[model samples]
Target chain A: MSINKLAYYPGCPSDGTAVDQDMSTKAVFEKLGVELVEVEDWNCCGAAEVEDPKVVYALNARNLAIAEKEDLDIVTPCSICYYNLERSNKALKADEALCTKLKGIDSSLDYGGKIKTKHVLDVFVNDIGMDEISSKLEKKVNVKVAPYYGCYIGRPPETAFDDPDNPVLMDKLIELIGGEIVPNFNYMKTVCCGGPLMMTRGDIAFDMARKILDVAKNAGADCISLACPLCGMMLDGKQADIEKALGITIGMPVVYITQLLGLALGIEPNKLGLNKNAVDTKEILGKVV
Target chain B: MPIKTWELDPNFKNEIMGEAGGERLASCFQCSTCTLGCPITEIVPSYNPRKIIQMSLLGMRKEVLSNPDLWVCLICQTCTARCPQDVRIADVLSAIRRIAEREEEAGNLKIDSPRPLFDKAFQHQLEKYGRLYDIGLAKEYYPKKEGSFIKGMKAMMKDYKDFGMRMFKKGKMGPKAMLAPKVKGRAVIKKIFKEMGEE
Candidate 1:
């Protein structure tokens, strides 16, 4: 049977600073005739902190239960959120002691271990397949884009769903939408996106963002795109800060991976979440289309 | 060396981590794997990952509460992948970071962390206008007389012409996109900082 509906989890960033990310993802998915069933009553997955022994797994545990109620696996676009939830779910399944601990916190929420989680990159690469995605390309984006695969998705390969060392979810999505991938700009593929910087330590967050942009710009990439909103928020939402801090013109069109596909599928920009970005993607796309 | 007794910032140890990572209680050991394998550390050695978890574990509340190092970890899995004890080294670092951000915002934590010349010059563009306008981030971050400013402007001008700025002016770069729904918590953010001693 053709898979028509996808259970989606838009992490905290999607609800806030990274809203455009979800919109763009859906806009393209909508055109592809794939419905996104957003996980109901979902809570924060506690990102990196859920793994601590003293910390109850209940926080990250809540999300998997929500996905299970619907009897469907979840698809997340944010790599950090995806990694956290996937990590928690994987751990819960492997360790009965962890499950016993979680049950003690919320006896009502049993760890039946029925949920499977994947980043949006996984759904795009595995479920949708490049052939179907390419068939929907109404327009071609000629920009030389460097695909930015942040750490959460690629480093472990468990969450990668694609090639870990040099994942091409970003590039495959671009090609599916008729964009040219710049083959050479690949050094910092598994690097951080500074999603951790928005809070008290923004200098380092912006520092990481500037480094990625430095490489992208030098490689002559017209744009940099990704699936993680936090990463996108760092690179796409914080472009000006990077320039102000570093005194470099690293103003490539930092966009969500799906936004590129949405454009090719004839989805409008407003629905794809481009309005809130720090970089002027409208300016760059203006050159391509 | 005997381990130091960590006196966690009550707000941070109890409220921040509890709210953030649910009080990640002293679970990390300093293997230097996070620092050793961290890609950011390779690029910038000052970006330490192991020291961060140690500070959080020791509950050196003030130090971790005001740390600029807190926000630098990319959540890149370098530390998460290497921890032999199953300590979520990266996430714990980030949870502490989120708490520090609140501290900085509330004005309780007065810290000075230098950004690179480029990021210092233009990060405000994203925070304010929500899009990167090269012309704008540059003006806001740098003074025109600075040699770096002149050099950056020249680069944009050169690239613009090379990429067909004249045609670009006609509006045809790529797909048009939109922003997503704003997360519901304008006051919560303010309150978190205020609770931490921000005005």
Candidate 2:
């Protein structure tokens, strides 16, 4: 397999709440022959809490500016980071004054918008191509996996890499891995997981996540596969809390898309950080072999 | 019964239009597609993205700006993606948030939720660490730095007593959360924040 490369921007949550995502992404990408070089001196995408648009642009621009020097398109596993960085890259490319203003923030940094920002799914589906990935799969995952795109990356026309209404990239990847797509999951595919509503309004966030879990459960999904860390944290990390709050049992294990792919590639469940998941992934893994 | 007057500040629309991604508000036609598409409205009845846009356009500045629901928008962009008129409902809500923040800072407006304070603490974390250090941000978030420090401190402790222990056991927070490492280019991050008037 020929080595492919990407400037990986493993967004904030990957450092802690979603370390399993970080580990699985690297392991799976490496297994697929894609080398993810951490964008040198990269910082946060500032998440959504930062309300100022200019500051959002500047924070993401700094990351892009660093990666442009590397001469490789930036890729992030986290959707919100992908959205924020891509949004900044587009904004700077269209407005010289904005780039100049961002540059003024740091005299040493340059913001020419020279590189592209890609979500990991884009690199997997479009760049690497499913045909290449399919050829490497050791075994097919036979269980039904619900593909959740969440709400961040696949939105706001210019920055969206796929259809905002019905994203099929994950579905394609799941198919490539020989995993059965949850047919009834089409309705809940792009719904908001209530990430931002978590701490501020726990009830609303929990209820929103509960609704998604209910949809997936009703679809008879064996597990849920997602890209964004926040969504993973919401569905996986908060599953118990949500269950307790809503007085409903949502036993579905939420796994990273990379982890699912890694599993299909015959990577050990432990190596894919399966144990790091809050909801037990053992049941789903038990069905695999 | 006497009719109640709506104190409409005509500048609200233009003020929101001044911000980035806010220019799309002109195209909104009250088609209610945004409302229909929003997942938040399904759960939280008070958070109507369409109504908020209508109110903002109507220049109901005081009503729109001070409402706690103003801070409730998830910025998920579902409404933005579905808006038939190309109205970026999420971005418009963000613009309203910015205006609300400025007003609150000036003491010209009052908000009922602690979200803004948490957002500010988050900003401070970004300014200091160039990334979100969850434990660091949480520490800054709960404790009252303003009026009624003792009461705020008690509330923060109560919260830690309530949810903090469980979060730590779940591996979401604790020594690991506190171990949120700083980004490599700390100086550059500080410079960007300072230059952007974030400091």
Candidate 3:
């Protein structure tokens, strides 16, 4: 595990609504003695739209430019943010024309597209090393957890951090960092969370998450560990609406992956950014801690 | 939250995302496992990881592609992998993109998309070198990057920082991409794409 630092890309969620998530990410990171540098003037991860490849690239390029300028590997907390940043970085790196255009827009920026972007969980597992995190485990969240990686980061390892179909980083991180991951948890291996919030037509998105939760419930997972903010917002935010809408209850709380790390590191739940979560982790932690 | 509304086909709402992947779409159960699993969905609100599949199932092809979800996906396949029901979220989006591109090129559809140009540019790169080269692609993508001082400065600085910048090119990886494999029948691969209606 590298002891020095983590170049952080808080992205959209980390600043406000996901502040809790951000806090915990910092706590765990600090506990590991890693210096965290926020990506300066980082723009959105092209989250709102993909209309202009030019604009989209510019947006993602802005973040990459910061990462390159600072000469630090980026560690984003949100899955979607991580995915887009890394994906765009990968794409821009490949299409020199795209990178050039992006560089053109930012005349003063050095947008070389060589910086490697990773999810916070990735830094924990890869850079921090689960073994170190495991060594620091003062307490274990015996809570049965279904580690949810979401889509963007894992698969297309070329673009993101790890393998999509069978991701072991989070699984390993959870265990080493002092938590339990349900190995055979049924829905642990699935796709998007009713993507883009079929919220209006939520019947589509709702049903998808509902099924996975059911699988977790069936598998006895008291909670699910997450890497993406949208994943948390949707799963945690909409859990009640989904439960009422679907006439079922998962009772399974959704918590940020970093929060778990913080807890393991003896960082209190509240200070570790547990508050930002839509679904409370209290009961789950109560049972585990 | 500036909402940019467009004049989508009047028939858009009446149709559903194609049924090919609808049942799986219906199973979304919204664990957001897909959304959580989806890396792109985290950054961009414009692209809905789950909605396109639903739109596809609803046969809302026009709506789905035109939604920006098609282009924003990054084709990471995370949505499909995270989907419990095994919904081909990315595949459905890919098909929608294919249809949208065909429609735009044929002028049957008018989309507020720079993606067509992006796609065309990508195609041109593929055709020229049978692979996408970053240096060449950059010159092709942004003309300003060619002779500007900022471009020169950035390029030199980037090269200085990351030594591998020169070798950074799309589709230049994996043994197969570097050299189009010698198939037992190269004609077969050609025929498949041709029959599949790909160039």
Best by lDDT: 2
- TM-score versus the correct structure, for each prediction: 0.66, 0.94, 0.62
- Candidate topping TM-score: 2
Better of 2 and 3 by lDDT: 2
lDDT of 1 at A14: 62
Tens-digit per-residue lDDT, A1-289, candidate 3: 6647757887554543455677788887788888899876554554522322334445566567767877888888887777677767766777886666444444533478667887777777777776777777877777778887766766644455667666777788776755677867633554566645331234556776776677777777878887877677567766766787778766678888888777777788778756545566777668646
In candidate 3, what are the lDDT values of residues B101-179, reduced to their tens digit? 7777788776564444445444344334422333443345433333465675565454223322211221112233233
Ranking by TM-score: 2, 1, 3
Interface RMSD of each: 10.0, 2.3, 17.7
Query: What is the Å distance of residue B103 in model 2 from its true position?
Result: 0.4
Point to the candidate with the largest DockQ. 2
Query: Could you give candidate 1's per-residue lDDT for residues A1-289 as a string of tens digits?
Result: 1567767887755644566787788787788888889876555554542223223244456667767878788888888777777767777788787677556555434556887887777787678888887777777677778888888776554454655557777777777666777766676776776765443355666777777888887877888888787677678656755676677667677888888777777677777766656567876566446
Tell the DockQ for candidate 3. Answer: 0.06
Give me candidate 3's TM-score against the actual structure.
Answer: 0.62
Q: What is the C-alpha lDDT profile of model 2 across A186-228, one tens digit per residue? A: 8788998988977677778888898899999999999999999
Q: What is the clash tally of candidate 3?
A: 65
- Assess candidate 3 and give its lDDT: 0.59
